[model samples]
Target: MADVRKHMIFHGRVQGVGFRYTAKYLARSMNLTGWVKNEYDGTVVMEVQGREAMIFELMKGLNRNQFIQIDWIDTEEKETETESSFEVKY
Candidate 1:
């Protein structure tokens, strides 16, 4: 599988809502390599690099939880950097 990297901006009622934790879990399960963080603008920012299928699965996981009110998910392709593993960044 080809490695793909994306910068994701999740909008809506996401902060303090276990979004980052869920994201980490999803990423780990999908064997993704990158990081997730809460932005000041109330958006959850994530960078994920992995197989396209796994990335799609991770996005699906992100969408399944009710605690997260995902109004929108903005994604953009990014240059893949060498990340050893996925993490929740503070």
Candidate 2:
């Protein structure tokens, strides 16, 4: 499958709940490359590049976190970027 990139912003009780860390870990485990960070508007933003299935799995993992409540996610498909590994960005 062709690699895909997604620019996503997750809303609702995402900050201060280890969302970024969980995403980073899940991405690494799935061999996806990208970065995740907290936004000033109480949302979490991530740019992930990998197989479409892996990306979906990453989102599923994030959604399953007990402490994280994801009301919705805004996703946009974008051009892929070169990245070596997943990262939690400030």
Model 2, runs deviating above 4 Å: none
Q: Put down candidate 1 lDDT per residue, 1-90, tens digits, no spaces.
A: 689999989999999999999989888877899999999888889999999999989888878999888899899999989878899999
- Give lDDT tens digits, candidate 2, residues 8-84: 99999999999999999999999999999998999999999999999989989988999999999999999998879
Candidate 2 vs. true structure, TM-score: 0.97
lDDT of each: 0.90, 0.94
Which candidate leads the pack in TM-score? 2
Clash-forming residue pairs, model 2 = none
Error of model 1, residue 58, in angstroms: 0.5
> Can you list the residue pairs that collide in candidate 1?
none
Candidate 2 lDDT score at position 14: 97
